[model samples]
Target: MSVHFKKKAANAQTAIPTASLPDIIFMLLIFFMVTTVLRETTVQVRTILPQAEAIEKIEQKRLVTYVYIGPKKLQNNQVGETAIQIDDALVDEVTNVRTIMYNKLTEQPRLIVSLRVDESSEMGKVIDVQQELREAGTLRINYSSKRDIEGTL
Candidate 1:
């Protein structure tokens, strides 16, 4: 007798069971959103900071002292070129800056004095302030700068 061939039906595909994929991705996103650390940024009067070819990263938050330089009026009531202002008063000499900085350093020995001198400040004044800080045993000093988005120093 001639053999009769029977056609076999194709088997149906197994279910992928992808219902947990969205849940898994959503859980991961929530985990990262909760566990990620966001750094706190310093805010103050905006000033155009001098650019540096080499910039170093500041890892820790320490005590900051702002030294502002703006227009000043002499005893004669005549407005003169900007002078360094420490805590709102005019800093006519290095001694004033030194005394204020020294007091701050004493309170926080590990203070990182952030010098925010104006762009128009005299280089000599800036150096003088730095020298005084060095003399007062405040070695850790940072110059605040405005950074561009490209990450250029």
Candidate 2:
């Protein structure tokens, strides 16, 4: 009795084709390039934001509307009173805050009002703004602050 072992012939090309790899990569690149969006928030007011040890990152900027609550930027090195800036206009009266904020809420239902209040700002002003926001049914508010300093001692 004779035992015979036969070997199978190998093909010239690979079993899996990689010819479409560049095409697939190109499509993916175009997909991400088109889907990527950059949102910009322009602040026209002078704000000296308070410092905080703990801070939360905002994931979606489209849902946020910045309300700068700080001292007014005056010329000739003069110190100005605390005021609120909505978009590009400097609104002196707290009463006007609601209408603007309400309008924003109408545009974006899930709007987050971020208060960039100064460290030296009066708590009363901040509270008043909060009250107005509450009246406008904008309960989603965020306080913007810088990272707190660490002590050597």
Q: What tens-digit string does per-residue lDDT give for candidate 2 at 35-70?
A: 787545455556888778668888887798888887
Candidate 1 has a TM-score of 0.54
lDDT for model 1: 0.68
Candidate 2 C-alpha RMSD relative to the actual structure: 5.4
Model 1: worst 10 consecutive residues (lDDT sum): 39-48
Every candidate's CA RMSD: 8.4, 5.4
Q: Which residue pairs overlap in candidate 2's backbone?
A: none
Off by over 4 Å in 1: 1-47, 56-62, 70-80, 149-153
Which candidate number has the best lDDT? Answer: 2
Those runs of model 2 whose alpha carbons end farther than 4 Å from true positions after fitting are 1-44, 149-153
Over 1-153, each residue of candidate 1 has an lDDT whose tens digit, in order, gives 234566557788888989999999999999999777565433222344766646676666446566654445455544467567665455678777778888888898778877776666668867878888888778887786665556653
